[model samples]
Target chain A: MPALVVQWIVALVMLVGAFFILLASIGLLRMPDLFLRMSATSKAGTLGAGLLLVGTIVHFWDFSITTRTVATIIFLLLTSPVAAHLIARAAYFDGVPLWEGTRRDDLRGHYHTSTHTLDSVVRPAPDTEIPEMEGDDFPEEG
Target chain B: MMLDVLWSAILVMLSAAFVLAFIRLVRGPRLPDRVIALDLLTIVVMGFIIVYAVRSGQAAFLDVAIILALISFVGTAAFAYYIERRV
Candidate 1:
């Protein structure tokens, strides 16, 4: 490929990556609740970072840089979901209130706060009617 | 010249992102919100580092990006653990 074409590709990739990162931050600021913000930031942030790294690889076109970029992207892909999960689980147990518009909570009655264990038996089967659990069990804030 | 302009534009966008994430960090009502903001901040900074590496033609800075990624994950996990135990 021509040098000019390659430069354009690099620029385009970097621009998109920066755009995603900006979107993620905006979501983080504008989302209504903690879980919603986590969802927005984790996914968008990881993709943005990965794309930025890929742009670096293309710009350099060096074997060592490519290896490092691949490694970094892989590490990011592997760790981001885990980190999001950990933080979400902690937030849930910490009793972070769900948004008022949240329609259903699958873990509502199944989680045992005392033992930090979930009772699988309490999970509603797809075909069965879900028992209406009391919302008063936990505090809800708008 | 075109690449230079694009690079500077990207840098500006990433800086704006950093500031937005920082606002969340400061305005977050709860600990987890703050933690998530910090995590996003770190990721945005990583993007900045990658852009800098490309613009400066310094492959060495890529290593710093990698290290930042690792450290941010560790910090997030530690904060999660603390939150879980505290409550």
Candidate 2:
């Protein structure tokens, strides 16, 4: 392909990537809680960074850089969600409060303090109404 | 010529985004919020580095970007663990 065309392509891709990054940052700034911010950053930030790397790959179009770019993209795709999950899990277990408007939290009663694990047995049935608990149905016995 | 203009424009927007994210990172009320902001800042920095690499025609910077992504991923995960374990 022509150099000019390649350059335009790079420019376009980079612009789109930059837009996503900006959107993610805005969401991060404005979102109410840790979970919402995590949701924003993980998805938009990954796609934005991936697109930027894609622009780099297209610009270089060489063997080594291409390999590295592909590796970087894959690493990002794999790790970002994992990182978000870990952080959100930590926040939840550490008792970070959710937004007031959050309707249903499936994991609310499923977590076992004794085992430090989620008891999947109490997993709410699909389409079943979530009961409003008074407090600590499963009492912590230490 | 046009490509240079486009890249420069994109770089300016990215810098603005970075500054806003930094503000959030500094002012975030909670630990996880701060961590999320930190993650965004790393990504923006990576984007900046890649743009710089493109401008300078240096493939070495791409290598740096890869290393950065690796380090940030690990760092974020470790921090999350510390928050959870509280140790």
Give the best candidate by lDDT: 1
Q: What is the interface RMSD of each candidate, in Å?
A: 0.7, 1.2
lDDT tens string, model 2, A1-142? 3398898999899999999999999999988888888888899999999999999989989998999899999999999999999999888877787776666577876766444587877755354344465545455779
TM-score of chain B of each: 0.94, 0.92
**Candidate 1 overall Cα lDDT vs. reference?**
0.89
In terms of lDDT, model 2 sits at: 0.87
User: Which lDDT tens digits does candidate 1 get at residues A74-115?
Assistant: 999999999999999999888888887676787865766666
After superposition, the stretches of candidate 1 with alpha carbons farther than 4 Å from their true spots are A122-142
Every model's DockQ, to 2 decimals?
Answer: 0.85, 0.77
Candidate 2 ranges beyond 4 A from true positions: A121-142
Model 1 agreement with the true structure over B2-87: per-residue lDDT tens digits: 77788788888899999999999999999999999999999998998888788778889999999999999999999999999998
Please tell me how candidate 2 rates in CAPRI terms.
Answer: medium
